[model samples]
Target chain A: MKTTAALSRLFAGIQADLDLVDKTFQERATSGLDILNTASMHAISSPGKRLRTALTLLSGKLNTYRFQKLLLLSVAFEMTHLATLIHDDIIDEASTRRGHPTVNALWGDKISILLGDYYFAKTAGLIADIEDPRIDHLFSDTVATVCEGTILEIMTSGNADLSQETYFEKIKNKTACLFAACSKGGAIISGASPEEIERLHAYGQHLGIAFQIIDDILDYTQDQSTIGKPAGNDLRQGMVTLPLIYALEDESQNGYRQQVQSLLTQTTHKEEDITAIVGWVTRGNGVKKSLLDAHAHGNKAREALYHFPPSPDRDVLDELIDFVLSRNK
Target chain B: MKTTAALSRLFAGIQADLDLVDKTFQERATSGLDILNTASMHAISSPGKRLRTALTLLSGKLNTYRFQKLLLLSVAFEMTHLATLIHDDIIDEASTRRGHPTVNALWGDKISILLGDYYFAKTAGLIADIEDPRIDHLFSDTVATVCEGTILEIMTSGNADLSQETYFEKIKNKTACLFAACSKGGAIISGASPEEIERLHAYGQHLGIAFQIIDDILDYTQDQSTIGKPAGNDLRQGMVTLPLIYALEDESQNGYRQQVQSLLTQTTHKEEDITAIVGWVTRGNGVKKSLLDAHAHGNKAREALYHFPPSPDRDVLDELIDFVLSRNK
Candidate 1:
């Protein structure tokens, strides 16, 4: 119960900051035109975790950084995250996200693609406003890393023989790198010590990896209703995640791999076939082991926070680490 | 004869700068990975006029501002432009651009969309490296404006009653604003006086309008062989350009509007019908008047350049203005 309360407090704080970022985005984009206002509001109001922005603000405040700079950095991080999501939805052929129709689904892939570019431009604009070339350079390099990661993911999609090293690199680029940037950038903006910045960045990086592992595990274990989408959707798309990696280790499961591969190759398969595969994975110990692995990483993430000075903000971050381990929905 | 010589000289100068910009882009994007290097080269090698980069370099040099800043700004502008074009090609369902298969046509829409985002991230990265928050803000705002313009165009397609004011606003955002930024940003980076920056901005704005108008005219007046694509492709797609605007003034041509509306409403139409509509618009006086209006804007563009002090660089600017007026392909 106490952990839930902490999570709520963190959520509310992040929500308020995101509201401010949304308002700033709207105010800057207003050209006294109704269409511009309407479109901007519609795009911004779409549901998201706002996790990237939260990481930026919370990390900065924990280090006693200036509020305004923290807000701007939060906005930039959120914009970059949003930009990638917009394009990713198109590539995934995902019609929905966060229980709402994706931009690509609602407006068609073309507008979604353009809007993604717009968000990227907005993020760049925010970075440029900071007036520090070092921050600018760091932000740009991070963006490139994210793109490279995405390309790597696309290239390796159906390759079951994908190595663990390749998987780590892909997840680091596609997920962890941005999270690391959020913490480190917040630290940079707030004038944190190099050591503190490094520690905070490590904390974010480990947390992101754990978070993605949990997500992958959920694909096998969670009910569609709670998850807000069909289970096994990733596997349906031929992406072999961690649970599948673990499940495929047994020689008996070699037949199971062939079944999954046949479904993928056919480009058409019954949902029941996917459900059977999900059941098989669940009956096995893979999901349980993946969860244990996630917990271990979550513990490591909390350990990285030890370098920071004691504060309530740091305490909330500590709670956040626990929340990641226990999150169900 | 004199005009041809001027254009030849202008193209030669632009070609040299484009080579340098291309080389720099390749060097910066290198990741010691063959796939990345190959993809970056293939994407950037796609055909374009390099107008944004050329404008940036010329504007900077026109003020006698000699620095590597122009190179950075030029690359940013070109990347931004290419990013938008990739998205635009998807939106327009265009299979060919500049007489070659579009990114979407060759790689599929999914890859095309991601590649566009890749360039956007790359452009943001470049701007971030420059470490100027003000310039970053400018680029971001410009990008947002371009997006809004594109959205507006999509929403307003086939609306025969679209006002001239709305058209100008759309073109300003979609085309002229970027050109203005190229000129003004180039000057700002070199620390030009505010007055000089504004004048160059005006020059770019007028030139961009002229350039777009000429393009619209060519859609009706130029043959497939000369223009390297089917003429009237825009009209077939239900886009009403300036020449169509002029053509619609006559009662007889009012039927042409109806034909366009009908074509747009249909899922598919006969090619003969499309060809007939193109022939009607071309034989009319509207296209001629539109060309004349384009020349007038070109003249205005030249007039805006009078604010700068005389130099050989300024002479090159004059030559570029003349080149814009005379180009037939």
Candidate 2:
């Protein structure tokens, strides 16, 4: 309810454009085969934040809003995002996202793999039609970074000794890069100056960092009903995210640190242990410190929007930072 | 030895360029991360037919033969092929290919998925550098078709009643499209005339169909040591390939057809039954009939090349049809 209200408020200016992005995505994503159509429809019909699309549109609105180009770009970005999620669920062995069954859960891993690849192929087709070399490079390069970031995260999975800098690096590649591409690509299409494009890119990168940090925090702080998946999934999957990193680094939480250390180093995780660590991180100033970092990034995102003159789109872009920080799911 | 000799004879003209493609594929496919680099190295070090690379280069040779552009295109095509194989191995639950362990066999499906995506990302980066909308569209569109083809195959996977037309459709999309892209993309880069481009594209399409049919044929006739994987894997996996389809449709082999039908349509496949079917396919008219179809497609590919005047590269391309048809593994 809170997220819906916030999205309605945030996307009020661009709802029609967002709807077009959604529609174009659905039509383009379908393969016209029964199983693929049904599976893709299920994945596409799910409610997503559409933050990337909003950023692209709002960024374009700041200048000459090229609806057609921006629409294609937004659809490409969101489709790419969906493709990654489908593949990530396979990697995460996740059954659900946002209270809905994942493509992997419903169709099995083989179909999920092909479906993800199909989306990626569709995304490439869309990117090809855009015809802008710069945008093309941005989209493809960002996807590569995202893949590398995922590899980095998997490599560091269960490593309790992961540094703060490494966590930042992982999130930057995995999440922030796509956000950067969205804003940067939008700006490019809208004829924004190089300096403005840089600013929007920065805005998106910081916003994405804040977004992922809050997501990590919510894993420790929110429940399945609220966050739409079980809490502490990161820990359950042996993922060492922001809150756990903070908790591990905090000398003040030495007792909880040992508990998390064992949990992280153990060959296998137990349900009760994951629950207990989620409790410890929630109470041991980990979430509090992570929130501070999230706020810092949020502030950085806000600063990126300062160059643009005061406008409705600008205001929405500004409010998006708060939404990123505050959203439960 | 025969295969190596054939490759040497066929690639004598373009061995330097082909060598450069190998060197470049190695450098670009690397992520500089240890695990990915190691896994990618393992995949790269294994000997692949590199027929796609040869097709791209030889196609270019027919015209301007832009060395650098063709090199990039070849690498991208091969990498795309590699990425698909990585993912396909996961879907097929394949333990090995060509006497080497698969990425999935070594690192598990999660790593294989990321590695495949990483290769795909790398391919995109290379494609972006090419700066041609036509090439970009071709690469992406071919990949999409390939994914669709794979999905089509999976959907038809246990259906004993699948039609020959549908089988043709699946292989065309899955295999021939990529081949067509390579040849046609090479022609486009070389500034081949539209008519020449279409001819080369048709040549590739027919050639790929012949190649895949032979592959399907080998699955029944070749032993594990000879083929690098066990024979009858298609039957084991419930995949109805050309030979199986042929055997089923052959009215003269009614007794064998019933046995094969029971094996295919049954809830579970047994080892002995699979062995029995492989023997039946070898003895029945299925292999002979499938071979005739392969030859028919091979002749069409040869006819498509009739437009090109005789040259060493043309001859090599011509011999490639024979090589593809006659190779034991």
Candidate 3:
């Protein structure tokens, strides 16, 4: 896996462009109303990885798309991400995001909810000028998919009935779809040809799958402080992600299946049990197998990019797949 | 003011057209998922005045725009209204809407919140096909404005310092904006000329302001059984609407402002106090002044339409103004 220093150097070429994204994001979040304006600023000011905007900027650079249009598209994608993050925090009952107090934590859920909607409105407003039918539906449909995916996850929470296939489906909806939209939407707006667009779509899909798997793996592998969230948060919330799903498969073949099943199917969890399960999942080959699976998706993402000529932008995208896969400790 | 029966007769010509709207609304509400599809259906099925749809259809008839496009635009307005309604119910903690269980009441706030987002996504999906930049920004900005307005209301909720001007400003952002959008959007999609569009915009603005004034007036004047919501709801929630703003003026002149000011400033309310405040506001002709103010706006709406030739659609638009005024009783 690439080191942090390597990843930073890979993106250094786009640092100037990313700074533009930061400025645009902050500028667009201004609402003119004091409270809303402040909340909007605060929501965007959080240090997001800017992954979606990076994907968008990188994709646009693949072709000779208008720089101005690409900037707008990048802003739209970032705002869309921020919008959902607010709602996601509310659902997770999370008090902090990126080590900062969440909008929900600081202002409460009512403001968080509306602030999220405001961000979405800002996203749509940014894209409204794009005037592409494909770009138009791509965003709203992605939102619907993300919301549906989260709802499905909530409904399936604590169910021992969760399958590996369902786990992939859930992550695809909840996380990967937006990434796919970010890649495909940038290409579409950038005037990428049909085949190129399709290839980029696949690249985004595979990259997103790998990204989410690594996220799930991080839940078990990373310690509390570095991850900025409690380890095994998914388990405490009764959510079964990839690591536990693989762990359960291993446990089921042995004698510990029912023990894990009882813990999962229970409506609530004791903290110690959560800790034990996190440990058990890590001790098993669950984390190992998950990383391997993520690597497989990463390879697919690389393969999808083979048709595009190797430019700096394409190289960064290629490195990003590795960067996402290597994010875990 | 026109009687309810007279208003119904005025709309008879568009009865067939409205039936088509009902059909389209139902057809569009269907998602493949059981929960969302059912929730969508439930959200729309509760009988509404369908006033926004009516405005769109009637506005379309004044111009030569395609009926099909008008249908899409009208449905967009209704869905936008429905989307905000779901979120509004969450903020209000409302249990029932129009005598039917609210989405928040039937589903938890989590579902309600996502369901609201789903509806918004649906609304955007519908309008993404419109290809008009004006309509696109209109829906999104109206959404932002509505959310901002609600946040402002919440921030100022127990503050006795709210002014009459501020109350109007709040309602304009929260309620009048959507109504104005319905009018202007319909005209824009229907290909109305710039001048005519401005006229229709004014008509909608005045109509919406009048509509909201009457709505606030009804909260004090109507019975719980008739309104399907508790009377004095705004007061119980510590919101100072136009009626109270006007009543405060009357009370101040009579040296009773401090008593009412203390009640308004309270965060929580006893049932009897809510009842007493409701009576106090009514006794001072707050409801009467509010209705008169609504009528003045209604007259302005009528005056805005003076240039349009007499047709069934135009006549209905005019009488609809009176119907909204008479709805208080």
Docking class of 2: medium
Best by lDDT: 2
Task: Give a tens-digit lDDT track for model 1, residues B1-329.
Answer: 44335455675755676678877777765664456566556667765447677788778876656557777878888878877887898888888876777777876776667666767767776766555565777788888889878877777787766666777778888988888889878877777788888888888888888778777888887777766678777777777777777777777767777776676556566888878878887889878877787778777878878777787667777777766766665
DockQ by candidate, in order: 0.61, 0.73, 0.75
lDDT of 3 by residue, B149-172 (tens): 888888888766688888888888
What lDDT tens digits, residue by residue, belong to model 3 across residues A19-41?
A: 89889878888876898877777
User: B93, model 1: CA deviation in Å?
Assistant: 2.2
Residue range B178-230, candidate 2, lDDT tens digits: 99899999999999999999999999999999999999999999999888889
Cα lDDT of model 1 by residue, A236-281, tens digit: 8778777777787767778777786675555666889988888988
Query: How far is A53's C-alpha from truth in model 1 (Å)?
Result: 2.6
Who is ahead in lDDT, 1 or 3? 3
Which portions of model 2 miss their true places by more than 4 Å? A265-270, B257-262, B265-270
Question: C-alpha displacement of B325 in model 2, angstroms?
Answer: 1.2
Q: How accurate is candidate 2 locally (lDDT)?
A: 0.89
Interface RMSD of candidate number 2: 1.1
lDDT of model 2 at position B42: 91
